[model samples]
Target chain A: MRVSAPVRATVQRLTLPFLIFMSALLAVLGKADVLLFDRVRVVLADVLAPVLQVAGEPIASVSRAVGTVENVITVYHQNQELKLENQRLLQWQEVARRLQSENEELRNLVKFAPQGAVSSVAAQVIADSGGAFLHNILVNVGSREGVARGQPAMTGDGLVGRVIEVGGRTARILLLTDINSHIPVAIEGTHDHAMLNGDNSDEPRLVYVQPKTPVKSGDRIVTSGSGGMFPPDLPVGVVASVGGVIRVETYADLARLEMVRIVNYGLDGILPDGWVPTPQAGRRSHARAASSP
Target chain B: MPYSRNRDYVGFVARMVPGTTTFLFTLLSLLPFPVPSFGSIAPSFALMAVFHWTVYRPDLLPPGAVFVAGLLLDLLNGTPYVGLSALALLLVRTAVLNQRRIFSHRPFSVLWLGFFGATAGAFALEWAFVSLMQVEFLAPRPFVFQTLITAACFPIGSYVLALAHRAMPALSA
Candidate 1:
């Protein structure tokens, strides 16, 4: 059926406003129920995983090339630094060896059973959220590779984040600097519990400190394992500042994440296989209760 | 008749260039760039594509395509606000379409300046919307940096789109 020119023009004019309104509505409602989007996101990510991997090849090579050139220029300086570091590590190695033997003896005395077996997979960083307000990375390894939601992703330095969304061939890790990310962490030496909260900043802030022990700058932060989401004693970061809001400089260089090891510590934790926890969910309360003891 | 059909097919593919490039740029923005100190802010290549197509071939890249591109971006980014980018992009296209003539046949500097304004508006809107949604004053540093970085990189995105733009006329012929 052919419409009048005037009628067609009116419909065309209305389309823009209709779409704008619909998008704004979706944006508002998206916060209420992310389950739908989460499903779509994972499937879409899985489908596009190959395309992203192929496209990222050139960029990866270029970055590696640049790294090699920089390495050559800084070779002497790095050599000096590595020599000093090696000497320090050698001393620590001796202490660690002694402690291992003593710990084994102690364990035998107590008849203590070791924790369950741990498994991990190394994954390449294939995509980034690339949004000003978002901080997440998509890795090549996913459910097909034994990755599960809430598993901790780490680098050799320390904790990077946790796998929040896992598809067939890809997984999205919510970095410690995302606003919605809140991990139960503690001061390393004191074991004083606090929450490491990401406020969309380079350095995540430390909240809920016991205050009895004033956290000073350079205090090491580690996962408290209160929620069972992460295993105990995962190194997170060091306190960068002690101002109004204490910030943590993550040991893992989040700026240039090339690879991550997604570790499964064999704990079921707060999130089950398909449970996507909203920011306002009761999991935080559960974590609080679990940690109080 | 066969020759005309061939021309028609070529014309169809040429018409598809704008939409295809917009989607490709959307994907390009998601790729990890590996730039040191870049953080999470990749330059919004989708915005450049939309701005270019809207100014030059608005008939080809319509509002629906822009909305889809933005939706794809938000979904891939895994943000809670699924349609925020869609809304922002739609507004950008609408704003650009209104003043399309000014950007047409203009100097590169003028277009760059206009994009700078659009980038600022888009990011400022995002910063405000996110802060409001979270019910707190979110830090503005990343948004500010993104806007600046996007605008600064406009020349590169524009150059790539310009090459594709040049290929369009030949395809139609």
Candidate 2:
């Protein structure tokens, strides 16, 4: 009743080619957003999240231990630097206080109800998108924590990325350095706007700047809230360099991210969730704005 | 003698050890370690496992296992472009299987050299496919670094797999 060895060999020979075809088909399906493929991904993420969390804990602990040792070695230098930095910060604090009061007076005169405070949920990164071609991480917080697709994920340092997929208990964040990431941001001093595009590189590139825009190296960058994909004025990073091309050195040392805040600024007016503009709606909005003015 | 069949059944289940262990190793390899400029240095520990098993235990480690491993990695990594590492891993397995006649009895250095060839081919295919998808020339540095690092990691992986092989009970052919 045993199968023939020749038949088994033929099946083995066909296996590789069939898999190759399936792989390409899956890729195309994934790219095309085929519903079944998408569901498989979500289910896979839900299944893998727990295993990743358990595995990541040991590595995170070991790294924390190593950081402790390194910190001890540099404590003296750090202390001296902190003292010098504190002196400069005190001077800046005086200027900041004056500006704060002046801004408040201006807002009161205009009857501005300044934007409501944004609430955020903190989550730990349980898994990393490990391939060099990709930059994403799965976090423990998800829909149950009020997490949603398009919510911004960040650390104390700066903007990390936006949530691409939200599961019941886990979510996947598309990192700033991911090739698909395209963020509209502004330079602090020059106020020149540019799109930050990740090319799967360490430093994401700043593209679409006006050639005449006076952008310099080391300029600070923040989200401009232009398209409302993210909250305005979130600290992004410094313009790392402005040679032939502009590069951003993100404030969130992406590799070191352990926990992140998923912020819901709630003013996503420009591209609000579920607000698809059909031709009729676009015309109606145009007429309304014109008549109101 | 009657207990021999039960022991044989145990051997059949034991054969699954390498695949499960290799799958776990693949998952662990994907775990993030926060280090500067270490993003591209994700050594293909999983690639090494595939090569080791395909060469040493071809019958035991089948193509389905490789495809599932690759598919899961693709799904997890979110690279619709790498189509996941599934196609790449299978190609490597096929290449290694073809070279088994020459590689099975070879020395460690020769095996490492063979891995270099397979890695180069895999990287080339990956780079070409990714570039075609983008319709622009994507930088090859990350892929190159990954190839070099993964290739460098081959010996350590092979050593570990060899140990795992020794520790498992022998299969009755």
Candidate 3:
């Protein structure tokens, strides 16, 4: 297996350029034909899920320790804040009780049909894309845990994002701040609909707003259920700014996500598996859906 | 003969240390760090590994290995552009190879400074490629932030690679 000096040198000289050219080609064409990459990514992610979880254990404990220390230092101040919050919540509870009875009576009068049961699974964040241009998290739960694509992932505070890629034991969540994310949302109270678009920033921009209602800073945004991808009225975020690009500050702390609930609202707005057999076709349909105003 | 075989085995593992560490570093970059806003701008540990090895032991971690490491990173991170990392890393290796003389036998600060330059180049290339693909000028703030973060974290990444490099003396080169 001995090679001549000229031949070996030629091969060595060409290797770098060849690989660079190949990579450039792949980068340009990868999005158009993502089926191969998707399969490889899912398998690789599933295989490495345990490793990521185990590696993240120390980080999780360290953050928890930091949180504990902070809580201890601020316990007295927190107690005062909690007491006032409790009093306010109690008043709301009384109001909610009255509304519940009135709503029940109205529902009986209208013979309204009850909504179906919603199912959800809790998943731990295992991996982060960690790229400047990407805002996705890989959770340690997937199809085996009943996780499905297009299901909303939320923290108790609010919507985090949606499950886009699901493996057997891992699912990747496209956070609300990812460039490709486009969730249909509405301003609270006004019910004026807009699209929440991610630009790889901490705050996602609110676009396609109804000109009739002026969006103001501090106005709440929630899922509009327009595209059927998400149910109506799931808490999203508050409008951080109204001028130039309307930005939303998500209620869920997407930056420090620990756990997310991927809930199946029983909505089938996403195309079924049979409709788009290939992953590329599925991605094209998704692109079309996201592009539509 | 048995003793020689044992020596060969040890030497083989020693040679593998660089490639193994690069792969591990790629995996390390993907681990979910609980720090606020850390995930989107996690330091490029894989690039650090490639840079370290390209400067110290380019023969062991060849272009092929670097390409595979980048591919593994892109696949594991779930980036839509499958080869962007590979391209960036290969370019880094090529650039580092040319300037290896400057880093060789230099103090830690010089290596760190060189790494900073490499980080800037890699991130700028990414920003340009992505903005071009997207057909709009992307906000450059994150790319700048990531470059600084990656450069700032180089000492740690380089220290880890140095520890692995210590085993290279055992290799039968």
lDDT of 3 by residue, A30-65 (tens): 887777888788898999899888888988899899
**lDDT of model 2 at residue A253?**
86
Tell the DockQ for candidate 2. 0.51
RMSD of each: 2.2, 5.0, 3.0
Query: Candidate 3 at A164: error in angstroms?
Result: 0.9
Model 3 lDDT on a 0 to 1 scale: 0.88
lDDT of 1 by residue, A55-110 (tens): 99999999999989999999999999999999999999999999999999999999
Give the Å error, residue A257, model 1: 0.5
The residue ranges of model 2 lying beyond 4 angstroms of the native Cα positions read: A1-12, A80-106, A267-293, B1-9, B82-84, B170-173
Chain A superposition TM-score, candidate 1: 0.90
Provide the TM-score of the second chain in candidate 2: 0.90
**Candidate 2: docking tier:** medium
User: Which model scores highest in DockQ?
Assistant: 1
- Residue lDDT tens for model 2, B1-173: 86898888877767877798778878877677776545456777778888888888887778889888887777776665535578888889988988798887778888999988888788778778777765667788888888898899888888888988886766534
Q: Mind giving the per-residue lDDT tens digits that candidate 1 earns over B1-173? A: 99999999999989999999999999999998888545467899999999888888899998899999999999998888999999999999999999888898899998999898888889898899989988889889889999989998999999999999999999999
In model 1, state the lDDT of residue A188: 91
lDDT of 3 by residue, B10-59 (tens): 88989899899999999899888878888878999999999999999999
